[model samples]
Target: MRVLAAMSGGVDSAVAAARAHAAGHDVTGVHLALARNPQTFRTGARGCCTLEDSRDARRAADVIGIPFYVWDMAEQFKADVVDDFVAEYAAGRTPNPCLRCNEKIKFEAVLDRAVALGFDAVVTGHHARLGADGLLRRSVDEGKDQSYVLAVLTREQLDRAVFPLGDSTKARVREEAAERGLAVADKPDSHDICFISDGDTQGFLQRQLGDAPGDIVDGRTGERLGSHNGAYGFTVGQRKGLDLRVPAADGRPRYVLSITPVTNTVTVGPREDLEVGVVTASKVIWHGESTSVECDVQLRAHGEVYPATVTIEGDTLTARLTSPARGVAAGQAIVAYQRSADGDIVLGSATITASAPLATARA
Candidate 1:
């Protein structure tokens, strides 16, 4: 089988590419140059788009004895993932860029190009399982499972995807890389937003969307509490850094309840106001069965799962949580799964459009 291995200059991707070669598949490694100018992005282990990362990927491919090439995906990545991320936030919603990257850039664009070039599959180091039954499942290493981000993929897109490091833990993969003479074996894992190397997301958004001064209002009293540089800086359930002038009458911390981008107003209230019992989403994609099922829905990446009753109709999906989920935000994905004796099977996923409080949901 001919495979295209995506080498991200990280230990996981390098090891995944090497393992593919060891499996005797005719493998060619390709590094995506996501940053138009590498100098603008962070260097070292902090970012995947740096010049250092591309060189590391090339070195790994050379050691693995596979043909290597770098694909210039900066324009596509910017238009699809980066621009969309800024737009989502500007629209007063929290978006997961990783999921967008997987759906639009990696699986869609890269996979399409691979198949056109006669490659059988595009393999990556994603920590998620693609079962023999063609269903996506959680990795055995739960701590590193990335199924939530990858869940946005369509069934057909998932068919051409290959995850070589799904069953292996990060520790084991690092050990294997060391044995294979891979230099990135001991490299620290990338954290935070890859594009925002300094880890200042608020600063990053300010740079992208610019400052749109807004009012922070108390949700209960409808009184203005403070002023913010931008409403895009806040998300649902953000507590710290509010800088409100007035203290709450109850003397409790106030969390951001919602953001209205058009009005440029951010509403803050008690933490209990963040709880939601119903999550309604759009642009649903089903990988396995498409029936209305009693399942578990994961709202955020690496977040806790909630038992839900999921009903799918057309392109819409609605999940009613058995227990209220705090901080349910719009534009994030709600991935549904079925807990089976075999494993937690990914049923489908959708982009959250709105969430209803327990009382409103029941009514």
Candidate 2:
């Protein structure tokens, strides 16, 4: 089988490509140049897709003895991941850029191109298992599992995907990379948003959306408590940096209950108001047959998983969590999983549109 390995200039991907080559698959390494201005992305260990990262990926591919190439995906990435991210935040919602990247850039664009180039599959270092039964499952190394972001994939996409590091832990992968003489073995893992060169998300959003001064209203009292530079700077359940003029009568720290971009209003209230029992999602991507079932619902990447009663109708998905989940913001994904003897299998995923309290949803 011919495989196109996505070398992200990281230890995990380097080891994954090496393992694919060792398995006797004709392997080619491709580094995606995702930034139009490479200088705008992070320079050191905090981000990927920089010019430094591309050079590192090429060197790793050299060590792995595979044909290498770089694909310029800056325009597509800006449209799909970066632009979508800013738009979602501007609309008063939180978006997971990693999930969007996997859905649009990696799996869709890269996989399509690989297949067109006569490659059998595209291999990556994502820590998620794809079983013989064609089910996507959690990695054995739970700490590094990435199934939440990968749940957006369809059955056909999974068919043409390969994850060589799913069965191995991060430590083991780094060890293997070092053993293989890959220089990125000790390189620090990328952190924060990859495109945010300074790691200051609020500052970055301010630069993009500009300052839209708004009022921060006390949700419980309907009284204006303070002013904010922009409503896009806050997400649901954010506590610090509110800079409110009035303190709560109860002396409790106020949390952002909601963001209304249309009115440019930030609603603040007690933390209990953030608890949500039912999540309503749209644009669902279910790979299963059942319209309704009991499963685990993960609201965010690397976040908590809750037992939920999930139902699908048309393009909508409703998840009623057995217990309340806190800080579930709109535009994040709700990924469903079914437990099995092998592992937790990804059932599907959807973008959350709203969340309500248990009583409110029941009513």
Report lDDT (CA) for all predictions.
Answer: 0.91, 0.93
lDDT of 2 by residue, 109-165 (tens): 999999999999999989999999888999999989999999999889999999988
Poorest 10 consecutive residues by lDDT, candidate 2: 38-47
Clashes of each: 0, 0
> What tens digits encode model 1's per-residue C-alpha lDDT throughout 194-286?
777788989999999898998999998999999999999999989999999998998999999999988999999999999999999999888
Cα lDDT for residue 28, model 2? 99
Window of ten residues with lowest summed lDDT in model 1: 38-47
Clashes of 2: 0
- Candidates' TM-scores? 0.98, 0.98
Error of 1 at 245 (Å): 0.8
